[model samples]
Target: MTGPTYRIEVALTAARQLRKLDHPARRRIQAAVELLASDPRPPGAKKLVGGEGEWRVRTGDYRIVYEIHDHVLRVLVLAVGHRRNVYRRSSGVARKART
Candidate 1:
């Protein structure tokens, strides 16, 4: 049987980051984000160290950082960017989410 899907919420900064990407990368990332609704912890998704309940999934050279709220059945997309900078940005985003 199918399970309930989680709601997906993208932070403003992450949305902006996604918009800055090329069409192909943007599409791939978008697809990955959508998949989180049904499977928040898909294969290769990893829990980020030092982050407050944060998780990440890879898509090409980019990464999608998010947090899964099981109680509310929601997935918050904290940041989306190149592997180099995504984690740095996500740490700040995760902090902001707590406030």
Candidate 2:
């Protein structure tokens, strides 16, 4: 039997963004997010320098930005977007405005 896995929590903005994506893109990102539940630091996952505990993974031209909380065993997905635009904005800027 499998042991416990980190829970995946998607931000509202990230969920909206995911919903707007094409079917293939959505599937790819969904798979990546699910993988984070089992392996928060999976191969090629990079820890973003400015945000402590925040990590990122890639799927094609898309990027998944998330943070791992060991205490709660959760993976919070903060953002997802194209490589060229994902890192351009501050994470907190749009969260409150839309949520």
The models' CA-based lDDT, in order, is 0.86, 0.79
Name the lDDT value of residue 61 in candidate 2.
Answer: 97
- Candidate 1 lDDT, tens digit per residue, 1-99? 988899999989899999999999999999999999999999888887667788888898899999899999999998998888886776554332222
Clashes of 2: 0
TM-score of 1: 0.90
RMSD of each: 4.4, 5.9
Q: Per-residue CA lDDT of candidate 2, range 1-99, in tens?
A: 765699899988788778888999999999999988888888888777656667788899998888889889999888888877676643642222111
Instruction: Looking at model 1, report the run of 10 residues with the lowest lDDT sum.
Output: 90-99
Q: Pairs clashing in candidate 2?
A: none
